[model samples]
Target: MLNNNLTWKTSPCSHSEWSQSDLVRGSRILYSQQWTLITDSNDHKSIRTVLPPGPCVPVSGEVLSGLSGHQLLEIWDRHGLRKCLNLTALNKHGRVYDDAQFGCLSWSECENKLLYVAEKIKNTSIEKHDGESPCRKPQQDRSVYCEDWGESLTNKSVPVICVVNLQSGSISVLQGVPHDVSPGQALWAPSSQSVFLVGWYHEPFRLGLRFCSNQRLSGDNLSVSCPRLSPDGSTLFYLQGRVFGPHNQCLSLQQVHYLYLLVVFRLLCSGFPSSLIFFVFVVASSAGFYDLPDYGSWKLLTVQKDLMVVCCSSPNTPPTLRVGFLPSAGETVTWQTLQQPVMTFDFHWTVLDVTTPPEEDNTHYSGLDFGAVLVKPSRPPIEAKTPLVVFIHGGPHSQFPAEWNCTTAGLAKLGFAVLMVNYRGSTGFGQDSILSLIGQIGSQDVKDVQTAVRTALQRDIALDPNRLAVIGGSHGGFLSCHLVGQYPEFYRACAARNPVINAATLLGTSDIVDCVGIQYSYDQIPTAEALAAMLEKSPITHAAQIKAPVLLMLGGRDRRVSPHQGLELYKALKSRASPVRLLWFPEDGHSLSRVDTQADCFLNTVLWLHQHL
Candidate 1:
């Protein structure tokens, strides 16, 4: 007999209800920053804290990547000192942790080896100017995009993959991977010695997955993202921004066997997916499947017998541990939701649609489906149509996951309905949709945002089309400003944090230089026509048309988009006597409105909406 006496309930999400420390980012946001605890399997109740040497707390730092079960590993930066620890016995730091950067962390299959990526720390012998400020000048030879070089945050770091054996305490740096390639998201295969790596290769600057064996990176490769090996070590799962499929004989690419692989190798699209689409494939056979959730973060917690412990979540909920029964020959597959440490599912989710033009409109366009979400407030709005706050995520390449977000919850507390748009080129969707924004940035993206607003007004009775405000950071900021300008009548007010204003002006000064050309379709050196095209595609071009008051929040230490990008937009609007405000965070980098500044940004945006919208 089956019992059915349960229903889900939604609660009022108090923006200021939870403590700051209690609030956590979605799983992907944490990456490898927070402590990962494992419930003792024997008791299934007692928890084990993965602590570092001396039981020090991780402050103002994040974990580099994935965690393996056998032993605990962590990297923390506190008081300008960075430390990487394993089982309290392994600890390594640079002469100065302030300049050190760490990439993803992975455990070898044998449970005795650790693989990670980091920037080689330079000597700590440099003298500060005037013996006071440690502010250093830009290194001319560094790569333009800081993100491409994930190891170093201040500027692109010279990234390298290193492996350490726990038994003998021996460490070896990978020499086979070329100097020009920035390696990231590395994991050990079932063989233990063989590692799969995602590298941002230079020359044309594209991303690809490579195989390494016996300390050598092999030439055989596949352009892939979020590559993962299944527990039995016979299948590989990954998502390509726009592509996929499979066939009969075992063919090897990057030393990994693929029975029937149909690969139309395209240049690696720009930006890693902020969210991921899960795809699983049989390594020894010719079969592949790509039909998992297109939005959210999934992490394999633990595997036992025939049961797989996994945690999955979207923006609306925190990561919940769940149990999945591996598929048998003919038995029905089952998954059970496990309890989460914290409970924060307080809002309601609604579906939204954005119109897409026909293929003849643009051949390179590859968005099979485009969907947005409208999150309503706990209490009904005073007016028939609730005031709306549309949020645009940055990374024209990135997507906003459905996981719990404090910032959005806080705004909803102020009685505003939030709309998140996964516009063209947004990650989580396949590669085709991700690359759709490459050549059609300003117009295509602008149209998509408008379509979302129209869809909300038509479908969601809770949204007030006339009384709307827009908020975003980075590329999101770029679009927020564009929305205020091109569709000036739609948004009442705008708040852009570290926005991209003039791409032509930002090309040389910004760190992600290749990104401008690659995403915007320009040459390394802009000709007169390229400059004109860049200006035309830039949001600043429509500055004169924007009637809304805009709030600008810029990170002074940002290396990716540079504060100048925000400053340029601020000054351009101010020149026309348009209402604007610029707030700067000196200690923060590109991710200004994250941990320390998130609350302030949320509050300020709410206040700005109240005063303007």
Candidate 2:
């Protein structure tokens, strides 16, 4: 039903102007001190606020850059972080709509225009027409039918952007933003009262940076991350990732900061130049700022004058922060690195290129190149003889960045060289490489992991192949178990967390079953040949070939990959009399190893590895 009765209005607010000074000044002081009660003496003692001598690092996520002297920081929970975020997780919230991303929570540099993206109802009511479908209800229907409110609620759900004036407390819901285009990540551009950079998502799911008026700047295929307007509003600095394509590596780009006004006059008067027009075409291809030193998988944190600050880490080093100024003309940009936080285990790292070889029949394929980060203790004497633990990441879509991880480092500290494999399907490489493992989940992805392990061995990175073990959760868990089955003689022991033992089984039962069906079989709810294909791609298909001892961890509340999947594998291993043990985290979900159970998982995994290897 095509209805034109939609209307928008401002919330209770007074007319007032905003200023930069308003944002800089806060009602409360931000203290660097930690307060503790001296309960032992029955008298509480307080200490003066003092600056820490070492580097101050963010707890998690990208450091949100506030325009004023303020910085929005993520309070990382010691418990599961990857799943439910900080505040929400601590308050026992999960699997909800994420509002923090985009401009759902944002304040303008001028301090006057605070923007927020939220789901709200349009005030106007729609008139029922004779031709309209019965399902087409009013825009804001309060009726609930048969407890199936999900459908009705979804039909009426509207994502809206509202701006609040800090001075007058006036709230205005911007008019003209179409309901189809969901707006977020609202960033105020330079010298703007209303103009700002907005992240807009269209149906079927596509995210792009656009002008506040809903004008998209990038192509549909590209996905924008952390889009920031430059200080002078000349260029927009953002990390762009391909939503769907062959390339795997994501790149950062400095795009023309289109004010819409400047572009019209400049194009009409001087015409688009060769340099200004280069990005227009190359955006779809491999792109990045070549002149700047490559910081692997960088998120632009903040920009100050000529300097841009970034926080990064490698498999070897702990969290590190650096501020680099853009060079003047031909001059090199100088980066001032902050003292990085050093972990207990002094580790060294290297990238092992697992480039596939051409097939024997000489297929035209040149072979996709996947890389893995191998981190070993820096202690020279033990580095070569250290036991190896290949850690595979879950998403299969997610890449194991050359970043510092507590889990992998803990393994290294326990006398094992950790290898974080960014398999063929991992993102950051681009869309094409990420989708490479779509239907090849059991074959190509397994081969990629095996090849990475082999490459590490061939390069003598993991000096002792006999003392090797593999561990991973979810898709990584699937590969860990597959390695034990497919290459029985290679790995001595394996530990899997919520592994996908049978895709055919997961397709019907798992919450994201369609994802498994699509990625593994390239079909949704496979029936005929697709069903058989899914079975063939599952680890259970080769279960009889298993020789290595196994340890399985199941998350009881896991909706993504139910605990039953792990239990099924446990039953199979027990029936076959294989040395296997099952650990169930009754309260945890798919990310059981994230927070609450991390200690238990770590202990059990280390014990299993020690006993078996």
Candidate 3:
């Protein structure tokens, strides 16, 4: 039995030091500073300065000193003044910043570059820079291109590519091979100069790499998550599957013996026609069983060369990351565990952060504390110190389990501390919390997450609140959007994948609306007025208020939330000039399954956070 009164403590097994300051840094920093600051730079005059001094870099080649905190100052310089921008301004004199704007300013060396795949959603032709019209007009069979290009990287054509221009919102299609292929995983190499396209065609999977500069195919082979290039792009590593069975002689002998037994059985039973037939049948069946071959679980398939490292996982295991020489098969191939163990945190039957435990035994979950299980980190302390990622599980009625999820585990492996919150309305804590969600979709449930965040911050101050991100699929996605819109200050970024943005739209589009109506006792579905009221509590209605950068992922075939849910909110946010991004997977339904699609979504998410958050 678990102790009910024990106060929750940070995971005792974790080697990393815990600090409250680290966790509360975002909120505390915001509170400690004066809401406004006025700086005078003309006379080298003094003013409040919490600004760290290091690089004297100018913004747009303009330096704006003596600027007030949380207040935007527009000074005339050759270009623009260099000053930190905030999401909100305290006064009308302050320049209100648009979070949605992807400014022309570049920060780090990698700031301006990103690689993504684009497919044609509508039949519309857009002209290319070369004075050629490559876009196909909307029809049933619109051309979809998979190309590798970013603002910083040069464009290249490949055997397979998809291109979407952010500036024009236009899509282009490019195909290398005539054969039809479904992309399994699309990864932009760390250099952001090339892309690796993985797809499944026929029986075996294949991988192809395309360099952006030349639009040339580097290499391709039969495998899943294969042809992984190193950060430097020197080597490729992949996993291969091989089956071992009976030796040739053994197989041949078994065949011969089975044939002999069939003849003998028939001959022996010949005395009685009916008995002979049955016995012969039994003998043949038994002989056939003996001829069955043996097989084994997928073994680590690794190809090592001087230039690259290639490794792959058995379909049963989660995708694994491997390191080796760049571009060539290396002499050594190292497999790194990409999944963390799941931990279950149960708190007062109201909230839980279900997650995978760390890989090592050094992490322990002694007694039940607040119904929250502390997932231990597998990597070293440096990796464990990565930003915390809280997953808001969907299912207003479902609970996030401590089971292994590709998304959670993948994010964890990408140096993120993942917390899957099973707040009010989640199942498994009993029917109470689940039922509590009926009319309290955004209220109490949201509170559960708020409490969990506080609890987590209490345990580890290093948890960068500024770097914190939330991701949710479906209902969880709804929660994510709602959280950002309602409490934009709490999160740095949000990814609402296949989320339900509008309750009314969901009531209309969901297949389970009829069932929901009966449970909630609403008549004739909520009226448009009632629906609007409910939507007022929805993220879609509040999309304009979200201050953090948001990413919205949608599936064209999703019936539960409807792609319109995402589209409507995305459009609203874009119109309001809120920082927002949208990614639509056309061939996919509600959740992504294709390996390539999954990989692309995951990779893009990490990259997005890396850039903005």
Candidate 4:
């Protein structure tokens, strides 16, 4: 029998009967009253304190009154100072944490002494075990570490993992990994003490996983996420198998033909073993299968002595977190349904949490009342006085779903209260709402975010209006730039990453110009006249009006919102004598995929916010 008895409750509005704006205020009030809790169903777990809500905490401070999660591991210890890993290129070159005093030191139960990683001069060879030195097992081959280091891997075209030994001041490279796979998150499995690396590939959106011990691949390669090991290290818990995207490089016929053939071949021959011909045939025969646009599905895979949970979801149905036993043939496996219904956002999303439940209650804010989702921090909330960082998601077509957003979680850990606004023109709310943003960039959509901020402040659920920083990327970056310039008083500072500064310029330079023109029609057509009118709405034109300090970042190979967009705005702002700083990634494209580039973008973004906000 399925465990459908699991209770799922909706959020309650404290003051239901109120005006639109008033209802939004009331909703915020209600959200503040409720406390977020992370529960570990497993017994024998250590309990940590949670951080309180508010914005008084500093970016570098560790105020854990209400934070929770596995990511919070070792956060409260002596390593707290090193919590903000400066993975930026600038900091690495400067050797900011080279000294022993600034480095992290942990007493290992197995090694009996300190273990840590740190930076040193580029050419210096790391000397191992020079007596009472901070380096543990220095004589051990540094290659035993899995991380990649040195100029070769750093300058490589594709993403690679590098492990560094701070004790010996040595760096080693881990090569031969697939170039298509880009590693995003890594952690040591609790149960097996084996390092688990999770990443994605573009062609078909395949997730890769490998278990490494003593710098060696162990066990058959397993694919999973939300991986949890049994307390006794005898089992592994994870989710697997949801094919995302076909083998299409672009939305074209050639790609489709390639993918169709590949799928057929995989089904007919080398793809399946002789043990499961019947099961494979059944899956291959499913109707309307290819019709479903590559919406990914995941199955919970639990690997115990001989058992595993292989939960999966489809585009049209909720996720069935399945429980299965191993060594049995594919079709012979038994299945049981999980209680929670899984929801999928965009594939790239990293953090997910259900905030306001589906059932709606009365709420209002600024003549507009609506339901809201507050992306709570994985760590505890900051003190009341700290600034709130509102991240505007890009793809004006995308909705800020409550999922695993690394950027939001990382900022939350750094003490910023974050809210991902799913304003009008976003997805998930259905097609009508999305179409509303067709020609309305700075219209009701902008008001939605404004209303959200006002609601947050009025209900005492977030930071004061004065302590606000708007940060975003792409279209989101455009909104941030527009927000500061158009509504200068609302934001204290702005951080825009690869923003579309001028829509007029974008319309001309963009590869998808024809597509955008069809989407956002021209109002007054005199060809050049209409284009010029569109330019008036561009943030680049209003650069002078933005009083707040700005930090702009762009990629060199950015063909989407060309680097010229960022550079032109920077130039305009500088000419106006506005406080502005620009950073560029010569080796990067539209987004920062390289670990070093990602780390740099993250660190710089936070530091810039710290300085300005």
Best by TM-score: 1
Cα misplacement distance, residue 3 of candidate 2 (Å):
44
Q: Model 3 misses residue 268 by how many Å?
A: 45
> All candidates' TM-scores?
0.66, 0.65, 0.41, 0.44
- Candidate 4 lDDT over residue span 1-613, tens digit each: 1111111122111111111112322221111111122222452121122222232211222221113311121223444543322233222221222111112233322322222223332322455432211212244443332222111122211232333333343323333334344332332322211233434442221111111110101112322233333444334344442221110011111111111211111122221111110000000111111222232344333242333334354322344333333332333443333223435322222222222312221132122233334543434435556467878877766665443455765776676767677775566655445545555565455666766666666654445567799899887898889888888877888899898888777765543332122333223233676566567667877787899899998888765667899998999989989899998898776665556667778899899888977
| Decreasing lDDT order of the candidates | 1, 2, 4, 3
Question: After superposition, which runs of candidate 2 have C-alpha atoms over 4 Å from their true positions?
Answer: 1-103, 119-159, 170-182, 188-227, 233-300, 340-345, 360-365, 378-385, 427-432, 508-525, 557-559
Q: What does the lDDT come to for candidate 4?
A: 0.46
lDDT of 1 at 169: 61
lDDT of each: 0.57, 0.56, 0.44, 0.46
Backbone Cα, N, C clashes tallied per candidate: 19, 19, 72, 47
The stretch of ten residues in a row with the least summed lDDT in candidate 1 is: 9-18
Candidate 1 residues 1-613, lDDT tens each?
0001111122111010112333355112211122233444673333333222122232323343234631234433346423444532332322111221225567666566677765543324443333111112134423334333321244434455566665666555554444455555666655553556565544343221111010112232333445566556665665332111110011222223322333322212122111111122212222111234533656554443444545577556665554444554554434444344355655676656566756324466543557787777777666577889989988776666666666777677667888899886676666567555666778777788777777788887667768999999888999999999998887899999888888878776664443443433223466788778788889998899999999999887776677988888888889999999888888766767446576667668888999987
Rank the models by TM-score, top first.
1, 2, 4, 3
Residues 242-317, candidate 3, lDDT per residue (tens digit)? 1111000011001111112221122122111111111100001111111111111122222322211112232113
How well does candidate 3 score on lDDT at residue 534? 66
Return whichever of 3 and 4 wins on TM-score: 4
Q: Candidate 4: how many backbone clashes?
A: 47
Candidate 3's error at 166, in angstroms?
Answer: 59
